[model samples]
Target: YFIIQTLAAAMILFASTLNAWQTGHWAITYPTCPLTTTIITTAIMMKLGAAPLHLWYPEIMQGATLNTALIISTWQKIAPMSMLYMMHKNLPTTLVLLTGLLSTLIGGWAGLNQTQTRKILAHSSIVHMGWLLIALAMDTALATLTLALYILMTTAMFTSLNTTSTKTITDMGTTWSASPTLLTLSMLTLTSLGGLPPMTGFTPKLLILNDLSMNHLLPLATLIALATLPSLFFYVRMAYMTTLTTPPTTTNTKYT
Candidate 1:
């Protein structure tokens, strides 16, 4: 991880120096500098934990406390994403699209078999990053909205899970005894995180897809939409565990 961080910083620094030398400004002004732009974008992708370069993020999140994981999944991505947002005009659109799509797919499919809640949320963060990237590729304003909504939903998830001290899916099954109200709200938050309709979380996704289609990106939008299904499944499964899943029924123990 240290090596990865060092490499990313070095790449970004080199790319920034090159861009500044060519344009006399330090904020990625040279849109035509493909090599520099790609290097800088890739470095940001690494920092943001977007896929093809996201393996470290989940593992790190898994080991952190709930508060630490909350910050990791929410606050940590902000600066890197801000960089991407600022450089969207110079970024290779195709590379961004491909990476974003791959993130959604990887985050969704890999998370399907996970039992650990933190790992699941890590994947969820990756999936959200994919959407945010797609939005950035099309419109930075929409990407900003996606980031805000993601922070809201992710914070809610971490707070609810923390309230019950849940670390795994099995732990969710027992949360009712800790705080039943929070358990119920946690179910709603899961659905919102999944971007299901009528939930606030769904709003950004709907607007992003609509914008993508308006910009003639239907194929990309369709693929991203399909990629969300697996994630939604896992979210629903967690919701069920939180709300409806029942423990073994103990018979009338008067006889025992």
Candidate 2:
């Protein structure tokens, strides 16, 4: 993991060096060389754990503590994604679209069989980043808004897990006994994270899809939507475990 992080950092530095060599400037706002721009975008994509370069994300998150995992899922994404957002206009549309689609597909598929809660959330984060990348290709403001909403939902989820000390789906199954209110809120949070209707998480996706359709990206939008099914399935499974399952008879206290 350390080696991977070091390599990613080296890529970022190499991209910056290219930027400096091409424009004789230290700023990333405007790059004169096309290769430099492409390198920066690719490096940023890798840093954000976009698909094809996201192999390290789940493993790292699974090994980290809950608080560290929370930081990796939320705060660590800001700089690279912000860089992507800043350079969206200059980036290659085809590359961004492909990356987004791959991320969505892989993110969803990867989480379907995972039992570790952090890995599940890590994959969820990748899926959200896919949506954000797609939105960024069309509208930066929309992408920023989507990222903000994701941060809120993810924070709510990690906080719930932290409070309950849940490390896996099995641990989550007994969470209702710890605190029914927390379990209920966590269930709602998971539902919202699944991007279901009437939840805050759905709003950004709806707007992004609407924008995509308006922009004649209906096919891409449809594919992204379909890729979310697996994620939604696991999210509902977790919620069911936390909220609907009856406590075992061997428990000391009943959850009423």
Candidate 3:
């Protein structure tokens, strides 16, 4: 991980230097909207596990401990957003729109079959990034608010999970019976994750859709928002499995 981060930093420095030299500006002014920028940005976003480049996230999450997965889900994931913000104006609206829509669709659909908890969250992050991409494209105050809200919500969720002692889904067997309060909170968190109404998660998605619709992007907004349903379905399924399913005979009665 240290090596990976070091290499990533070096590559980013090189890329920034190249962009600045070519554009005669320090902010990546030149070729930001060209094929070069798109390829680089897309590749970086992929490395960060955002949509279209999201395949790595789930696999990595599965390999890591829950706390490590939480770190990846929160702090590490924000790099792409920062990169997008830096070259905000340079991103093509059409490309942003397409990537956002595709991410939501694929993330949601692929999450359906996943039984592992970490993989579920990995895909959920991809779905959320879809909304984030849409907000970035819209470039409105409301969109900005939505993005901030999303970051906050995700952070809160990660913190809550990190505080838990259980390291895997199997460790959480019959968790509700042992700790009903935590179980309820877990349900609430997952519900929020799916962007259900009244939760912090839903707020941003709603705001993004409204902003897009007001800007005459109703069809696109509707489609992207609807694409979230598949991810939502699986989240709901996980919630049910955790709470509704009968406990296994081997299930321990304790959370730890």
Q: Which parts of model 2 are misplaced by more than 4 Å?
A: 251-256
Task: Give all TM-scores, in the order shown.
Answer: 0.94, 0.94, 0.83
Clashing pairs in 1: none
- Candidate with better lDDT, 2 vs 3: 2
lDDT of 1 by residue, 1-256 (tens): 5777788989999998888888788867444588899999999899888998999988988999999999888888888887777777778999998999999999999999999999999999999999989889888889889999999999999998888899999888888787778887898899999999899999999998999899998998999999999999999999999899866666876754
What is the lDDT for 25 in model 2? 82
Per-residue lDDT tens digits for candidate 3, residues 111-183, read 8877677787788888877787888888756556766766666665555456555444554555666567777
lDDT of each model, Cα atoms only? 0.90, 0.88, 0.72
Error of 3 at 50 (Å): 2.1
Better of 1 and 2 by lDDT: 1
